[model samples]
Target: MKTGVEKLTDVMAHFLGHTAIRLPDDVIAKLEELRDKEDHPLAKVIYRTMFRNQRLAEELQRPSCQDTGVSQYWVRCGTAFPYINELEDLLREATIQATFETPLRHNSVETFDEYNTGKNVGKGTPTVWWDIIPHSDQCEIYTYLSGGGCSLPGCATVLMPGEGYEGIVKFVMDRMTSYGLNACPPLLIGIGVGTSVETAALNSKKALMRPVDSHSDNPRAAKMEKLLEDGINALGLGPQGMGGHYSVMGVHIENTARHPSVIGCALNVGCWSHRRGHIIFDKDLNFTTDTHSHFVYEEK
Candidate 1:
């Protein structure tokens, strides 16, 4: 009989494998909506091709892109959950198995060694971030496949107190103007403002896990999202960066109270694919996921 940790690992591996090929419904919907909004002839063709590509990947049961990307998980674990102690090991094993089963692109090359791990598992690969929840027995996981191209344009900086919020706006506008097209626009832009670079950077990436249409809760932050969306779309990079009226699907901002002397801001850009999913597991190890709710997994 399998241990609870083993069971959770197996389920998560399968979930990650499926996520590579089948996009979430929300992403598909957004892509379709963007497809119709395109005025440029070639841009329309690109969107159509994108749709067809997704269909073919699903039907063929293969990855949607050759660069399946480095795996990353954001985990919120209830302190009362039984498997909390085992999550790190469970996630690592799952990622190793998924690399072969999904046949993910062997993207993890050791920097100093200059050789591929060939299994997407390395010292820090498939990085996991954790948040502890009080008084609950369920764990929620957000998985993201961060492809190389999409990860290329991520930027972060600390702003002097004098620069103000407008500094953040300028920083984002400058980055997008310079490299936004590189990440395959109609991008989902995530902005994080915090007291330091690392916090801001982490929050920026977390913001990407939110649904594309969702906005920040803080009114000030929400307004910033709107302004950034409008400013980016006005760039006319459009679908696949071939030039069109819409350059981004949405802008999201996540923020924390910052030091009075400094403001740190970061940007994470998700391409049109926006490959991510969410899953929840109870203490019993029974699980549910929004990304692949239709598919049933059998325990061994």
Candidate 2:
């Protein structure tokens, strides 16, 4: 009989491997929507090529993007979850397994030592962010493959209070104008505003886990999401920056109260093939996910 650790490890490894090869359902849907809306022949052609790539990636059972990226996990677990203590290590082990099985590129190198770990799990690779629940018996995991290209232009900064919300808009637009093309476009932009740069940065990434069509509960932030989406699309960085009618898939904003003195802002961008997955497991290890359509796990 498989232990809970072993079973969960197998499931997570499968999910990680699946994430590499498949674009999530929402991502594919959004891509299709963009492709249908394109008037530029070049942009349409590029979008078709992208869909072709996705089909072949599945048929060939290989990653859609070579940079399978460092595995990052957002674990929202309950205090009453049976295996909470082992969750982090299970994620690490699963990442190692997926690296070799999914044939992910070795992207983890020690910062100071500058040596690639090869296994995709270095000292702090496969980063795990935790959200602890009070007394529930289930956990939800968000898996993201953060490729170097998409992560390259990520940045955070503090704006003087005088700058106001307009300053936040300028910061995002400035970043997009400067290096947005570096990340493959029709991008998903995550914006975070909070008390400090660190919080903003973290929340910016977390914003990426939100559904593409969803918006913040806060009405002002929701308005910002629509406004930024429209503004970025106006940049016309469509279809790998070849230029077209749209520059982004969506813009999501997350914010918290900050001091009177400064406003912290951060931006994270997800490329056209935003590789992310979500799964939930009950105490008995029964699980469900809709991120990857028609996914079936074959234990080997």
Candidate 3:
């Protein structure tokens, strides 16, 4: 008989494997909109190629990109959940199983030791972040694949109190101009502002998990998202950075109260592929997924 952790691991492994080949519906919609909006001939061709790549990946049940990327799991767990103690181990085992079953690119290598784990699991590989919710018996997990190109452009800074919001705009514009093109354009930009660099950096990546069309609830933050989106699109980096009218699909900002003396900001960019999935598990481990609703598992 399988333990609860083992059952959860099986579900998670299937989720990760399916997520690799399938582009979420939201992403496909955004790409199609960009394809129609683009006027440049080369940009149109690039968009078509992207569509073809996604179709082939899904049909063949293969990864869309050779770089499957490092896995990152963002978890919101109910304090009353039964498997809370085993969640981390279950996630790690799931990632390891998915690495081979999905045949993910060997992207995990030990730092300093400098050896590829081949399997995506290693110390700190498939990093997990947890948020505990009180008085509930369910858990929500968001899985993100952070590809090397997209992850390369992530930047964080601590702005002096006097630098204010303009400083944020300047920092983002500078970072995007310097490195955004390399990540594959028509990118989704997530900005996080908090009291410290580490807090800001994590929030920045979390921001990317939001729906593509969504904006910050705060009015000022929503305004900033618009301004950044417009400024970035003006850069003319275009689709795949090949030169087009649109450089980014959207801009999203997530922020929290910050210290009076400093404002820490971070940027995380998602490429056109934008691979992520969400699953919710109840106390009994009954699960439903928003991102992989179409996936049907074969009995082992």
Candidate 4:
């Protein structure tokens, strides 16, 4: 029988070996809506590229983006869970192998040497965020493949306390005007507002993992979501920075109370093919797998 660690390793290897979750119906609907409204020929071309990429990824069983991104994991750990040792290494190894087998574009760069790891693992590769909960024996892990083109446009700023909500909107607006096109229009935009830069940046990344077009539970944040979504769509960035009726696929805002003097906020955007998936495993290794373009039960 496979131990929990072996089970974990198996899943990770399998996940990296395949593309997760097909674009859901709503996502496909939104893309269709944009395609019909898109006006610029170039923008239309970009949209076509995205569509074609998705098809090829499915047909060929390959990643849509060569830059499979810096693999990021948001892990919720159960206190009662066993086999904690070597989890990180297993993840790193999975990424290394996936990079080779899947041929994920070599994205890791050595800052000082300017050399690509080509293997996708380096000093601190495959960033993992942990949330340890009360007594339990199950864990849920969300995996995200954040591409460079989309992540490059991420923005953060600390607004003065007096500026209030309006400042946040302006910051987002300015970022879009400057780099939204390059990040890929019709993007999934995540906004985080909190006490410091780090919190804001982290929350911003978390926001992208949320279901496309879902709003935050906080009433105020939900309102901001609607406002930002409307404002961005008005930009008509269409797909791929071409002009259209919609510039963003969705807008998610995550927030936390900040110090009285600080109004820190950050923005992260995901391109049309925003790649992510979630899996939950029980103590016996019974798990709900929601990656590789399907929802199924898996066991190792």
Using all chains and alpha carbons, the TM-scores for the candidates as numbered come to 0.97, 0.98, 0.97, 0.91
Worst window of 10 by summed lDDT in candidate 4: 291-300
Q: What number of clashing residue pairs does each candidate have, in the order they appear? A: 0, 0, 0, 4
Question: In terms of lDDT, which candidate is strongest?
Answer: 2
lDDT tens string, model 1, 107-143? 8889899999888888798899999999999999999
lDDT of 4 by residue, 122-175 (tens): 878788888887798888877777788898889888889899889999999899
Q: What is the C-alpha lDDT of each candidate?
A: 0.89, 0.92, 0.90, 0.79
Question: Of models 2 and 4, which has the larger TM-score?
Answer: 2
Candidate 3 lDDT by residue in tens digits, 1-300:
577888889988988888888877787788899899999999999999999999899888898888889999999999999999999988988998999888788889999999999889788988999999999899999999889999988999999999999999999999999999889888999999998999999889999999888899999899999999999999999988999998888999999889999999999999998889998999887888766667766536
After best superposition, candidate 1 residue 80: deviation in angstroms? Answer: 1.3
TM-score between candidate 4 and the true structure: 0.91
Predicted structure 2, TM vs. truth:
0.98
Once fitted onto the true fold, the runs of candidate 2 whose alpha carbons sit more than 4 angstroms away are none
Candidate with top TM-score is 2
- Each prediction's Cα RMSD? 1.1, 0.9, 1.1, 2.4
